[model samples]
Target chain A: MPVSNSLRSLLPVLILLVLFALVPLLSPSNRFLSLAISAGINVIALYGLSVLFGQTGILSMGHAALVGIGAYTAAIVARDFNVGFWLSIPLAGIMAAIVAALIGVPSLRVSGHHFVIMTFAFGQLLSIILTNGGDYTGAASGLDVQQPVALFGLSMDVLTHYYLMVVSFVALSAIASWAIINSRYGRTLRAIRENEKLAASLGINVGRHKIGAFVVSGIFAGVSGVLLAYFLRHISPSQFASFPSIYLALMVMIGGARLLLGPLAGGILVAFLPELLNLDPVQSRILYGVCLIAVILLLPNGLIAGIVAGWYRFFDRRPVQPNEPAVEREGK
Target chain B: MDVLLQQILNGLSIASVITLIAVGVTLIFGLTGIINFAHGEFLMVGSIVTWLAVSNGVSFWLAIILAMIVVAVMGFALERGLFRFTLERPTNGFIVSLGLIIVLQHIVILFWNANQKSIPRPLNTVWEIGGVRIASVRVMVIFITAAVVAMTFVAITRSRYGRALRASVEDRDTAALMGIPVRRYITGVFVLGSALAGLGGGLLIALFPITPFTGGTMVMKGFAVALIGGLGNLTGAVVAGLILGIVEGLSAGYGFSGWTDAYSFGLMILVLLFRPNGLFGGTSGPKMA
Candidate 1:
């Protein structure tokens, strides 16, 4: 695809992101900011998920474990040593990546349902360890992350944290994801997703690329988890369990994992729906599940594509150029 | 000797419940190829319905029967509304089932509060032999689950519907081409599976305390058992469920209670890694998306 066409393709996403960036300033309320920050963290987290499910074609019901690992790393370090947020946060991502690599290497060999189960078992075991690790993980009830990160000698406040989450977490992820997807690495993952045997036959290091995608995803989850710990200021086993992975899956699907800005849309909806509707946990979870099923049935391609497909149908119009593929950029 | 006997008995009772759930899950997988995570929700609701019916002055046995009918109907509706479209895609079916799980748990919670509820055993007696004491309810659970499994075996081996279902599982398209009403048979498999889940739930209310959240663990163990036994392998599921029950029983009994959950998951992952084809000889068939 041409550069102008690719930029045109990303126009809608850019517009949506510009609107999201202005939300904190426009709303100016702690409650709203909290939701935005939570969504922002999830958006970052689900980027890894998109890479896994959408790009690498692996379903990890254990992605939450990576997040937990990251959060635990940050919380344990900060609580014990009173380390600053910057170092702790990056360390969280690095630790999560390390753990992801460890778990992913062996498990990634198994594809489809078996692979999903492997990750799920891994996630469940990690949760058990965190809950039963006693003083180390603050046990099941959770640990208090009392210290906030300092940026330019500014102790963290809600607004500042929100901005930090957006800039450091979301922007950094988007840039990294953009860079990777644009690089040969991204094309290789998409190739693997489309057909592993064919890609391998074409001289791809299939296993390495798969592990690399997972590690990159783990990094995203770790940073998001670190942000979640700081944002919530309290972390618990319940916060990072199997359900969170499903919840992340819901967001990715709802926003359209195939689209660059899909997680952003998904993140905002999932993070705020409970608070916005004042729904109890049960009701909210039910809603999420219903939403997930609805998405899978009606929007298999994802929310953006589904909506676009519906729009095109309503208009009964094919693309203006029959010879050109609409928005086809070879995984970039 | 008494302790060993006790643990063995304990393991048998738990394995019976697991077999009921696992067989149901594997049955659906065999016929329809959906790993209905909401299958455990049937078990949860079955118990809850039995509790509600029994508390409302119905006879315990009658309530159990009613629960089975109700859940079977619910299973039918879910099959028609949701699972039908997902038959071709196992992954989509999984996501749909996850959705159903969320939906079913919340629906139950909406009607019955999330508080854990325990039902009094219908038999309310203990049988003691050789210094090993056993609750009559436990005996009933084991016996009833055995009867159900035996009946299922007979149905599969002897009955026309069972033959058709088996054929469908063997090769869905061929079964259809050979004039088997494949979709209807698949639906029957789901209803029968759900009924088994209901029966397990009914038995469960007599022996174990339950809440809506209990379905999560039930599904995990059921799915694990189904995998270990091999998907669609009846005998394999039973053996796997028994092994899992014994392992869990011993772990809980021997004071490694905190690690028991981890222990079960470890078993599942190990099976997944070492025996992806399954212990009893069913091949892996989940399609890659």
Candidate 2:
């Protein structure tokens, strides 16, 4: 049953990949492909956020800073050391993970609101440092990723090829996220999220696990950053500021952070919704704000979770159990 | 000596504005447990109101008052309509405030356009003491802020409502058990905090140019003051605000203007590392569960 459940979960990811594989064949506009590629990169990072916020119940508002660190690391190395995109991927991931662990150490000491505020400050601090990094960080204007990603002896500068590359990465990230969600570490993290004190009492190293989750998320963000840098061919301090961090958090929150398809659903919806509606950037942001508030009020779990629950209720036809405690229902 | 005096005066003025914003932030956090990310927007809205009033021939002083009143009403409405529902889950409240930040900012942008707005300083005279020169506007801001802080300090420490507020902050469940009407206090605190933020915004625009986006940076500084002072501790906020303002003023004056924000944030990170509850220890604030 467990094997089948795992396989069932993988089915949607497979479908998603198959659908992505069809995008190039349809011959969509370069602009559309670019948006898809951007969304795919964001989806990769969102998966990491899912593990941290969804499974571990730790929300790092500085997630974008980690992404920034990865991008900057890749860009700097590529610029100065003649490091190619392939070589910089692991370097970026390791650098982001190290920074994440460093920030997570002191931040994890304070839980709840303080943790949120601290991460927020850290995000701002990273942007400030990058902006003031002078020529080393390329300053406020930012640095260019001159190294193009080459796969199979072909440069992926074409929109279709790049989209395919991003899609493949998305698939790989989704599968890895799924594996993590089903792993023993995932369960332990969920236990910590459910009740830190109880988990601590049950012999869990809650602090270490929280830092581990952050480091893992940082690695994911780092790879996503690499993809983003190469895709855009430019990286800026402003891109990874506190506002962008908030934007990433908004994506995860809207998509249902805990579910397998949440990141994909959220990433696509947020990336496409404004474009599809033809709304300007300001109007779309306002809409996102309203949506976030409404989601929190009406569907606290998230859009995907709410939809899944609705689907279950429609099919199950279970009698109303009024006297059953809310906690017991949650336990089930 | 002259440079030191000038920096001290500048720091005092900066601290005054931060104190107003930080106090409101701490008060709201103390009572409602929401970080109120939109508190900066509340400040922005206040500055907008002040700008509108001043443009329409209202006195700058009256404009500040109008801004505060308008923002206070906004606070009441948001608390009653939106934030009241999220009391059971503070994290949701925080997220809701994040949404509110975006919504409020863009709404301001949609209506007013995202251009920097500035108000003529109400007092343009400079008072020179020895070799040091201080703008009368800065002095006025410092005096006004000091008065407001004193009034708030006295009210919270000595008044009946203040006692109830402190009690609610200490423990919501017990405060309600004691018939303190914690709900009403929460509303009152929210309104007061919003009003203070509005005043801070009004003062902010008087000092510098402001855009709809100014709130982001201001709010970070405000939170730094609030957290460094101790999240819910009023006196701590004032002290932290002073320290932050001085640090920022010194950094800016010493030709490290670009890194002034870095200094404040770095100080905050260090304080958080050493004293997670804030420098003064946030005992007067709600106990973290």
| Top-DockQ structure, candidate number | 2
What DockQ would you assign to candidate 1? 0.52
Scored against the true structure, residue A328 in model 2 reaches a CA lDDT of 9
lDDT of 2 by residue, B163-215 (tens): 98888877777888999998898899999999999999899888888999988
DockQ of each: 0.52, 0.56
Model 1 chain A, TM-score vs. native: 0.90
Tell me how many clashing residue pairs each candidate has: 0, 0
**Which run of 10 residues does model 1 chain B get worst, by summed lDDT?**
B280-289
Deviation from native of the Cα of residue A27 in model 1, angstroms:
5.2
Across B1-289, the per-residue lDDT of candidate 1 in tens digits comes to 6777788889889989999999998788754677688888999999999999988989889999999999999999999998887776676778788788888888888888789987777998888898999898889999999899889978987899888877777776688899999778878889999999999999988888899888887878888898888887788888888888888877787887787678667777888888887778774652222
Model 2 CA lDDT for position A287: 91
Candidate 1 chain A lDDT trough over 10 residues, lowest sum = A323-332
Q: Stretches of candidate 2 above 4 Å error?
A: A317-332, B287-289
